[model samples]
Target: MSTHLLSRHSHRPRASLSLLTRGAAITPAITLERGRAHEACGPARRSFALWLAASTQGPVLWITPQWQPVTLNPDGMMDFADPARFLFVAAPRREDQLWAIEEALRSGAAPLVVADLEEPPAMTPVRRLHLAAEQGGSLGVAPLALLLTPGSGGAAGIESRWHMSPAHQGRQRIWQLDRLRARTQPPACWRLQQKAPRSGLQLCPAPQADLPSEGPHLRATQQ
Candidate 1:
């Protein structure tokens, strides 16, 4: 057999267990339910996306819209993931992103895929992505579709949906997580923070949730 043929046929098998949500409060059991699209929404969308991806094996395919104000920073990614394990595809058109994301999911080439769509995509594209994620499931990976949409509202046909935004106290890097929709559970919220790679996401206790919510955390931190 030719090396090319072998390479094409190869698959890196992994366990198909429920994924860790890395949430707090009622979200401790909130999961990256296998074979489904789980939407994440809010201003700190990237953090929500990376937090989920950090829990999976990588060489993750991160697809984002070209016009997004935020771009991937290698130094910043280090706090949550391996900079090298990520392969990014910046699509200039939302249409192109739809095709690329579905292809990546259907190919079963990567253990996880994150797509930061440019807008709230219609049901057709999201449904297709959900189906592709399901096909990838048979190959071994739980294959989560983590979409970073714009606000508290979520996409249709998603297995689960979450919302998160940066939370602050002076310069502390904390985030608030909310599981807005899920098949197995109702909405829940949590306070979260980054942890060592092997430790993944950790829950920040309630005693600390009393941070100032007077202004947007992003605006405060950028000053």
Candidate 2:
């Protein structure tokens, strides 16, 4: 028999085109899984920042825009003991009030500033606050502002944003903490009660397994 010329392409197995396409489809899912895993591993940036501000034993400025004639007694003061220092400012008007608050924040006299106003602040104002905090070497605790409204308008400088809400009461006058916004971590809810026998308010623990049962009872009314 006459020998046929061997074809160069005959011997090699065909490459799997389907395998390449399948790997391409799997890449995005793998990336998403890794992202979720990272989020689960760390404490939310906002919550951690709030905790730091609350724990700081320095001067703090509290701005209450909605309620007038607000006062903080020694006991009420102790409730926010983490931010050990404070200055209470009540502003009724938006324009005038924000300006005054901004001035105080820029002063750097206080390490923390809290604004409880009716409307969420604009992005520019929030950015200013961030810059002020950075320059002053302080933290700002804006529980109300961050909660009730859209903080989208605020400046891009905010390190973290948190949404905190009041939880139910326990045996004493303990309040629960609900977190609505925590960028890097999953949302968390917990209870924090204080014992203030000397200050007149009592501390009570929630009826949860992790919480302890031995604390003074908080009176129904604020002293």
Please provide TM-scores, in order, for all candidate models, with all chains considered together.
0.77, 0.48
The top-ranked prediction according to lDDT is: 1
**lDDT of each candidate versus the true structure:** 0.69, 0.37
- Clash pairs detected, candidate 2: 54-82, 54-83, 60-85, 123-153, 123-154, 123-155
Candidate 1 error regions (>4 Å): 1-28, 195-199, 207-223
Query: Residue-wise lDDT of candidate 1 within 196-223, one digit each (tens)?
Result: 4335556667434435332221221121
Q: lDDT (0-100) at residue 105 of candidate 2?
A: 56
Candidate 1's displacement at residue 187, Å, is 0.9
- For model 2, residues 73-172, the per-residue Cα lDDT tens digits are 4443334343245565667677766675566656656544555455555667766654544444333332112212323222232333333223334434
Worst 10 residues of 2 by lDDT: 32-41
